[model samples]
Target: MADTAAPPTAPKSMAVPLTAFAVGGVVALLLGIFSKVHDPTLDGTTTLGYSNVLAMKTVVAVVIGVLAVGQVIGALWIYGKLPIKAPSWLGKAHRAGGTLVLLLSVFVGYHCLWSVGWETGVTDTGYHVPARTIVHEILGCIVFGAIVVKIVAVRSKRAPGWFLPLAGGLLFTLLIAAVLTSAAYYIGDNGWPSRA
Candidate 1:
């Protein structure tokens, strides 16, 4: 007698990636909504002893960009894509740097949302915002979304190995773009430590 039995299916799960993407989308959407609905103060916020909030944000963004570059190098080293030998402490340092970046980003983001709100390139006084500023505002929200996705992907064991790298790369690119659109533009237009 022959017995018929069904084969066991693959154990792969899509829960982690799906959840990460969903949560990320929600985070980005919430930020956009809150920024648009909230009334902006435009009174300027204090940070790092700097009287100029824009200048302070720009400086901190540049610092975050530099640290992100370091993170990429560290990731490459860890993955054996770099020629340099990976130190035992590299993982811890990488995590610490990521945490620092997250905290600083929150600080900058809070100030932007609280003071500037979301710029729509049009003002009540007939003043027009530059295209660059508009793009920066969009990127600011997306970057935070990418951050959430990357964090979720990194923490989940069920996430595919490819997902982590993809998420990290996307997050890094978004962050750099945000920095360029805002911080770099501010520097070019008003110079460092801009008085305006």
Candidate 2:
């Protein structure tokens, strides 16, 4: 009889990951589709602690954008992809930051879709509509879809190692783009919210 070593095992099936991703995508796509079907509230939805809806949304977006910087740093550290070693607390902070980002997105996204919906050059008040508005609207949908992917990737054991980082990067990019197109533009035009 010949002695032989066991063969290396293959990776497990990706059924769970695929299902999670599909579910996320469908949910986001549906939300985007429904949001577009609704009419814009024009003045936007106002809430407590802000001069107006625009001011609130802008501030929230800006906050998220700044937090995104920390998110990236934390992710890089946790993954050991950076030059420096990560502190023990770094991973906990990363999780907390990601959770906060998701929660904030829900609030901001609801306001945008419920109050204003999709805006165009002709519809929204203030300066004339620009190409950036269209880009922003398109990116809004993408951001939702990306959020789904990111969440699923983070929670699913079936997710590939690279998926989490990729989704994180995508979310960061989309958030920045969304902020630039709307909040930053608003600040440039009208300055920060004071009186609404």
Candidate 3:
């Protein structure tokens, strides 16, 4: 065989998670805007709270999402220009996005507890499902888990290639599920009061 220089690095699995984060970022922005306008109960709704939490949440989402996207795009660019070498920028964006997602998870988790503990009347419709708070707690836990796994897997040397993106996809699915469920509740006349 002719002499051939071996490629430097293996193909990284950051794309899956990064895409997930990017989708999540876009979904989060949409959810935040929807919550602010339609809910009328978010922090900055009235004159008293003046809370920037929602704004910051949206910002974080966008930052993390964009970073993830940038990572994937950067990797592609690197691969294109130097086909003989290993990918250098593969996980850079994903790492940043995962970190931001972790932060957001913390914020949301704290907010959940705060709203419950302070009796701030955080819930809008009283959540009428059986055991009332189940959805909140369950969804929050899942969100927490997804982010943790994504972060850990991304950092760990033992992580399989699919874990990163799978984690991200899970997060996006959770958000979308919540939003759709809430929207359906608002629209469907399934024994719920009309907001108008």
Candidate 4:
């Protein structure tokens, strides 16, 4: 008699890509909610006498954006998605880049949340801040949360090969969006000060 049994399906653990995306989304949403509801405090520590907090954060933002771009390229190379051959050390470089970006993000986030908060208005300029400011705040928080998800996905043994690349791409996109809306806008509106 012919065998009637069907081939076994791939294990549920293989669905890491989809699960990672969902986890990232949920965590990001939670962070947004937390940022809105939490009370903010004035953090003067980030600002030295000669330093402007906004300018400082902007510098960090630029660094983060550059690092995030490197992360995406490294991921592509490591996953064999890039056209060129990848070197053996590319994977290690990718991990190091990700770690550095995450650490820098923490510093940036602390200053943003503790020093400025939501930034609805500026007393000196009396500039009517647009809706984008709040949106940028929420997006910044989400970027950090998404990074958390990416790290978990990276360490998961059951995660599929595609999961890492997808998480990395998502993280890179979010980081760019946060930097563009906040740092780029600030620099474009007010020229970077020599002192801070």
Candidate 5:
């Protein structure tokens, strides 16, 4: 007698991706809501010996941006898109770089959420928030979501081959956008912190 085992169906194959999306969406939504609802307090805030919190955030953002660039290069090399041959340890280095990025992002994000909160346009002091700041805030939330999705997709065996690349690319784009809208703008506007 011949074996009659059935192949995986479309719905079963899609379960992991769908769950990843849902979890990512929920995380993003929760972060946004919490940031909006939380009261911002900048009193006695320390920037870990930097000139100020913005200086620390700026420096960290720049570092994150650079690391993100490295991550892209590493990924390309791993996937054989680069001309040079990928080293055996490249995968470990890539994972380490990603972990570093996540840690730094969380540090900056915590400061932003705790000290600044989410800003739409005007503040209580009648100060109009720049459009760039608003864009940065939105992107910040989405970037975390992208990170979650990428992590989920990367870990799941059931995820489609195309999903990981797509998630990674999206996360990279979001990271760059967040850094550009925040760190790049700050450097351009404030002329870079001397202490930072």
Candidate 6:
């Protein structure tokens, strides 16, 4: 006999968290980036004004760097291009990597308070934040979003591997953007114009 009950569909889990994290990553990346134009030091610093962890750009940079590598590893693992050895450690690494990026994202996000102050026309200058922070915030928010999705997936019993590709792609994109945008900003002027 044909089954009378309707088939079950996957629950709408990890959607909200994922979206928030993704958007957050982009926002963070952009804000961090564009704000650099006006205040280059904020892009990196050794001062412990906000978080001691971020006192050293090397620390934050290294972690984000690792997170980027983890993303690539995860992506490769998911696609079966890379061998999956010890799923447990890989999961732990991915989580740790995500946590690191999340922290950095928060650290970078601190500058956005200033960027938004200008970009939204809060200052005498129609556009306050330089173009640098724009890309920084965007990348940071994207990382934030990817982390959200990773956490949700982990909590929902989804393999940690699944989030790797998303994280990797976004991180890679941010890296490329960071370099290109920074170059362009410097070449054009102090930094790209928020409006331009």
Best by lDDT: 5
Model 3's TM-score against the true structure:
0.42
Better of 2 and 5 by lDDT: 5
Best by TM-score: 5
Query: Which ten contiguous residues of candidate 3 have the minimum total lDDT?
Result: 44-53
Per-residue error for 145 in candidate 6, Å, reads: 4.0
Rank all candidate structures by their lDDT, best first, as comma-separated numbers.
5, 1, 2, 4, 6, 3
> Which pairs, if any, clash in model 2?
121-129
> Candidate 6 on 10-68: residue-level lDDT in tens?
55545544664666566556644555455423333333332332233323444455566
lDDT of 4 by residue, 40-151 (tens): 6654446443267888888788889989888877877877888999999887888888889999998888777776666565534687767788778878878877787788
Global CA lDDT computed for model 6 = 0.50
lDDT of 4 at 137: 85
Cα lDDT of model 1 by residue, 1-96, tens digit: 776788665455677778888888889889988999999885657766665778889999999999999999989998889988899999999999
Q: What's the lDDT for all of these models?
A: 0.86, 0.79, 0.47, 0.77, 0.88, 0.50
Which window of 10 residues has the lowest lDDT sum in candidate 1? 7-16
Candidate 5 per-residue C-alpha lDDT over 1-196 given as tens digits, one digit per residue, 9 for 90 to 100: 9979997654436777788888888888888899999998877465876788998899899999999999999999999998899999999999999999999989998888888889887888899998888889888988888889999878877778888899999999999999999889889988776663
Instruction: Rank candidates, TM-score, best first.
Output: 5, 1, 2, 4, 6, 3
With a 3 Å backbone cut-off (N, CA, C), the pairs that clash in candidate 4 are none
Clashing pairs in 3: 16-165, 17-165
lDDT of 3 at 124: 58
TM-score for each model: 0.89, 0.81, 0.42, 0.78, 0.90, 0.47
lDDT of 3 by residue, 25-104 (tens): 55444443333344233452221232344333333334444544554445445446445554565556545655665575
- CA shift of 39, model 6, Å: 14
Model 1 segments more than 4 A misplaced: 1-11, 42-44, 194-196
lDDT of 2 by residue, 1-196 (tens): 8769786654544764577567767876787787779976745456647787878888888888888888998887888889999999887888899889889877888888888676566754575667987787777777888888888778766566777777788889998999899889989998986753
Task: State model 5's lDDT.
Answer: 0.88
